[model samples]
Target: MPNPIKVVLVEDSAVAREIMQRLLDSSPEVDVVGTAQDGIQGLDVIAQTKPDVICVDLQMPRMDGLEFTQKVMSDYPRPILVVSNAVHPSDVDNIFNLMSAGALDFFPKPTSGTATDYEKLKSALVTKIKVLASKAK
Candidate 1:
């Protein structure tokens, strides 16, 4: 098998961050290289880790995913996956902006805490990561 895909997760919510890390780590194909609480810190972590793919939240302090995506595309130029729970109408526009800014995909945060829900989300997240990591920057 090929080397596991390196990943950095950036989420403002501590609970969400931990949940995402656990879910990603459960898979053998992905490696959680680093994590951060916000986009500013995310940039620093990304620079240090040099991950193959990035998972970021849309809302956060200091910098949001949109700005972070823009900065990463300009400086590092890697495939990014936006993992967010922004369900509001306006937030859809923000997600689109992120795509235009260079983010390759978006995954909605899970709502329920059931094992089934987690399992489904985990599969989706891992699959998205694999596809994004394989994408050419």
Candidate 2:
């Protein structure tokens, strides 16, 4: 066995943040080192945790994920995985811009559906985290 993959989550929605935290914590291979409700707080948490990967949401107050990603790329340079509920064209375009800004991957926000849907999203996130962590290290 090895050290669990360290992760920091940056999301604005309290319910979404809590759900993600719980799901990630359920995996023994991952460790939720820290969490923040916005990008400003996220920067502090990421600095403190020094996580291998960051799960971030695009729409946040104070500092959205795009700006955060830019700052992180310029100053910190780390693997960032975007999880957003972007439905509009402009929003989706911003998500792509986030990738250009330095995010490693992007995924649509998981909807509150059936258990199977939830499980599938969880698995996808976990898999992406593992891959990103490995590549980051």
Candidate 3:
């Protein structure tokens, strides 16, 4: 069988972290190797796990998502998916900036506080991670 897609989630919110973990756990093809509460911890997890994908929150403490993304791109060149609560149309420009900076995609934070919020985008997210991970390899 093919290797499962290993991922690391970097989210500061306790509720969001649990929900994301549960969502990833439900998918047999995607394996969440580790999780971090902030960008600093996320960096440590990434160094240890070298996961195929890194899902990061935008407004984290210690090191915000943009800074974290910049560091990862410069130092590791890994596939990154940004998760944030900024979903307004104006935020599209900012999201595009992140994409230009190295993030492969952005997903709006789920309002339900559950992984079920990811149901609509899970397939797409997985596909994008796979594609970007291949490029990183």
Best by TM-score: 1
* Ordering by lDDT: 1, 2, 3
Clashes of each: 0, 0, 0
Q: Which model, 1 or 3, shows the larger lDDT?
A: 1
Once fitted onto the true fold, the runs of candidate 2 whose alpha carbons sit more than 4 angstroms away are: 87-92
Name the regions of candidate 3 deviating beyond 4 angstroms: 87-89, 113-118
Pull out the clashing pairs in model 2.
Answer: none
- Measured on C-alpha atoms, candidate 1 has an lDDT of 0.90
- TM-score of every prediction relative to native: 0.93, 0.92, 0.85
- Model 1: per-residue lDDT, tens digit, 1-137? 98899999999998899999999999999999999999999999999999999999998989998999999999989999988888344676776798899998888865558999899989999999999998944
Clashes of 1: 0
Candidate 3 residue pairs that clash: none
Q: What is the C-alpha lDDT of each candidate?
A: 0.90, 0.87, 0.82
Q: In model 2, what is the error at residue 92, expressed in angstroms?
A: 5.6
Number of the predicted model whose lDDT against the real structure is largest: 1
Two-way TM-score contest, 2 vs 3, winner? 2
